[model samples]
Target chain A: MESKEINLPLTDKAIDGLQIGDRVEYSGILYTARDAAHKRLITLADAGNELPVALQGQVIYYVGPTPPRPGRVIGSAGPTTAMRLDPYTPRMLELGVKGIIGKGGRGPVVREAIQKHHAIYCIAVGGTGALLNRHIKNVEVVAFEDLGTEAIRRLEVDHFPAIVVNDAYGGDLLEAGKAEYRTKAPPSP
Target chain B: MREIEAGVITEAVAKLAVEATHFLPEDVEGAIRGARETEQSPLGVQIIDEILENAEIAREQMLPLCQDTGTAVVHLELGQDVHITGGFIMDAVNAGIEKGYGDGYLRKSIVAHPFGERKNTGTNTPGVIHTEIVPGDKIHIGFMPKGGGCENMSRYQNFLPGAGREAVIKFVCETVDQSGGNPCPPLVIGVGVGGTAEKAMTMAKHSLFRKIGQRSEDPEVSILEKTLLDAVNALGVGPQAVGGSTTALDVFVETYPTHITALPVAVNIQCHSARTKHTVL
Candidate 1:
């Protein structure tokens, strides 16, 4: 796998050279959703309903950021656990969502769907809410206004960062990394 | 008995909510640093670095460690000798929760109902407060704002009397391993052994307030903590489950003798942020 540095408004062709574990700095439009939004999205897809926004080749970020401070465009925004959205991910991928920005490990089903659908699971630094939000320059509630923090939001980010934990070729950085570091416990006397 | 003003309680709670959310306790900071130094995965080290950096930024900028500041769970040990004045005890705590979350700009996470029309209370008010009457002249407050990720991963298992320690160990390790990366890594494992089912779970939640890496005095349980810690880390769930050897920074176990028929255990996994504060008034 070759490592390459790429710049803004990323497209699938531009990111083709990256592999699992490769670091990438992204500067583009990022979408946000929590459990409620994901459920709503799944319902829409099942109903063959038009989505609030076209997800074609877009990156969906799993986050429910705090309310922004007085002057900031967005508050502390960070990746949330991805597994909770596992059930809805395949459908999103089928709809042309290209990448998922989140933390924690995705289930085997989601990983397999990523391989089948040419999508990628990218992990942003979890718990680094305030620092991560620094990269976000604009934030607007796109839908689900009544959900409060759980509302779907659209954010414009600059050099927002992540690592590919699961890729389009059935590779999982989580299991591979674990295999590299796990130590066997000693036998009892 | 001396009378203490409800306003004092309210003020203390308000300060505690903001402070606990905005700042990482010294012990928690130390634990994260320690994990960073000892973690084997390059990714894990990187994750810890960002977590520590996040802590610093949150404090300096007055931002929360995570967007989920969580519901304010307060445990109050009120002194029997002290009488409250000005207002009801619960009212004072609610006021504090309201002001703290409001002024701090933290997210309001609580809903009026778990089922049916879920409605946001807006103020993050009516904190889950547990009151215990104790013999003392001052009221002691312990604040633990638990995140949804970890709280959602909590487990309760009821083992038969013959199940013994191995069963407890297996149950806990499996729960953490199954949790994968979701609970946030370098998790604080809180084990409540013995007591009734509800007590065991509450003890599990309350156990999170213990200082990081601090072990119970019970020699047996102290050893159990070490064993559990080693087993959990062995899962290679590392920070954020990105995979590493230091998945759990510490494990705390609190126990009480139980009915001969019961050997209940509850495991509560806490995220690395570990927000908690202690105040005596």
Candidate 2:
């Protein structure tokens, strides 16, 4: 169970080194986006217009965090379901996006893109937002403020924990991990 | 008739929203701790540890347990003999939600329209409020902040009367299997059986408010709960679907008398967060 300490704007070497089920402590910048912001990003990309933030060699976290209370940098910030972003993921990867952070299994197209683009997909513990928020050091809205929480935010995170669920080599931990632990179905009642 | 002020209802619901978001109910917390100890996979154990740690941090700092904060669902048990004063009950509940979501810094997740513009309401108003008239004079309010991930995984089916207990067992297990890690296992599954389609769905959602590990009073229903729980845990979906022996914390079933020809069933899946709070006024 070797754990890797990686930074954002991930290097090609770093993405290549990741494997399904590998533990990772990610630090550095992470841009947050969920359904609404993702739609806007895809629209912008389709129109051949510039994106609000550069995508090259960067990681995007599929999250829409709670509003920060007074004196706090951010609120409970955790990953949303990832499958909803599948349509936009391949395009982002084509733009040199290095990694994605979200929960649950990704679609086939996104998985194919991960292998093709040599990108990685990681998952923070879903529903563990309070703990995850402690790892974030700074946050600022970068685009789509009209979407409110769904607005894209540039974040600086330190020791933000996650496990690789999809690797650049066409491995998927969600399938492999469950297969390894699956037991015989109980007899019919 | 006893009179209760609208502001009182608003204050109560407001507090409930914040507390339910920040605190994992005692039963749910206990189940997670128990799951951590018994979980066979190292990865599962690690995930459970993080979940418990998150709960601790949320409780200590008064921060929300998850980023979703969820769509506020308020269930009200209004006594027949009691009178609501000052304003419309629905408005007061909505006002409470606005205050709670605003004051607690919870996310305003409600959208104005399902289709078309898809604009956010900005205020987490018009909470999904369910009301029932009861015998007692005191009103009971149960507040549950339900996240979208798990709700998305819920399902309903109208099984033929011949479908039997085996069919149910299979359906529940398969649902969890298909959901994999998306519903955020280890989960609390609520099953509703023996009612009209809508009634069954409502029962399934309401059953989730029951304490974890509490069984239905009916002998046959309790057995079904146990059997479903065991079968689901056997799926090895584990914590976050990474793999483990503790996929489900518990299975709760609520049943009603049904027409002889119909056997409607519904499954409402709840994530490990399993947040709920109640107050009687």
Candidate 3:
């Protein structure tokens, strides 16, 4: 499959153009956050306070990396489960978040929000952290260093690979992909 | 009685934590490679290849295989005649985990309280260590850095004895279907049956150490393993849940006799990053 090269600060046009199952190489910035960091961000946003990480027109990568060993930039960085971030996604989209990177299927609320807010969802293979970290060239802990791995960080990545699983126009690659193969699959033994 | 210093166990456990995090077991690595050939979806095959590549990169660089790094689950087979000197068994094991996580650059994932403050313990410890007295003078320890993704997908139930084999078949298949890509398929499915609730869960987790194609010693249990394996693969959840021909590399079932009226089952999933290491002392 030919991977479409996607530039960062995803344009509205670029977001609309993606379809489920399309492979893409992302070159730009991804803000890191998981359960704890997400909680603090949303809690701040709810109080109508200034947010730490820039959200508008940016992609948020759901990940928590290990401590870097010696000279490495970051250690074993890979996506955490995206579904855990579902509750905050609508507001994140409302705050002009353009894309999300994570693993596994999302619940309906987030899927609907992705379509409503004109955003996209993509997945990198989970547990492929060792390989994935190679793409992340730099990291700065922008928020919540006290949370350690769960801290929010600004990351500069180069040619990072992922597959589009959900897009603005309502396509889901995971479900469609499973259905296609299930038909040909032998009945349960 | 033979005596071994508890400090030795601590050092050994530390090495195990690092080794388990960095290397994918050979059988697990081999199974994923084999899954690539049988995987039907182009996406599934590509994902499987990435996993294999990740395994090599982690081993060479001494990187923790996954960011989750995992809650270290250690199984100790302690010999009846062996005496552990110097300190407590679990305390030493926990110290080893602290040293491993600190020294190896692995993440500390354990929370202090499940319900309450939920503060990270800062060391991946009190690694769910299980010790059982056994029949020899040597000690055996098995370590698995059990990641959260697949562990979250695990399920347990107490079935009515009348539910029987068909019920189990249904439960096992449904679990995989619901798990989808969350457990990071292609998976190694571990099933524990015919025990009490806790025993069933422990056995399910323990069975994951079995290599692919290794069956239970019991003939009847072996057949059930094959049957469950076929049914799970037929679900087409595929590698990384992108849909393909190979959802599971193997289905390992471990059984124990239980009460006449109760039939308990636990399904534990091992993701493609299937990591574990063991040592005998």
- TM-score of each predicted structure versus truth: 0.95, 0.98, 0.98
lDDT of 3 at B263: 92
Query: Model 2, range B165-251, lDDT digits (tens) per residue?
Result: 888888888888988888889999999998899899889999999999899999999999998998898887889988788999999
Error of 3 at B101 (Å): 0.8
Whichever of 1 and 3 has more DockQ, that candidate is: 3
Error of 2 at B66 (Å): 0.5
lDDT of 2 by residue, A50-131 (tens): 9889999999999999989899999999889998889889988887788999999998999999999999999999999999
Task: State the DockQ, from 0 to 1, for candidate 1.
Answer: 0.53
Give model 2's TM-score versus the native structure.
Answer: 0.98
- Say which prediction, candidate 1 or candidate 3, comes out ahead on lDDT: 3
DockQ for every model, please: 0.53, 0.65, 0.62
| Model 3 residue B145 CA deviation in Å | 0.6
- Per-residue lDDT of model 1, residues A73-96, tens digit only: 877888888988998888888988
**Superposition error at B37 for model 2 (Å):** 1.0
Q: What C-alpha RMSD separates each model from the true structure?
A: 2.4, 1.5, 1.5
Stretch of 10 with least lDDT, candidate 2 chain B:
B117-126
What's model 3's interface RMSD, roughly to a tenth of an angstrom?
2.7
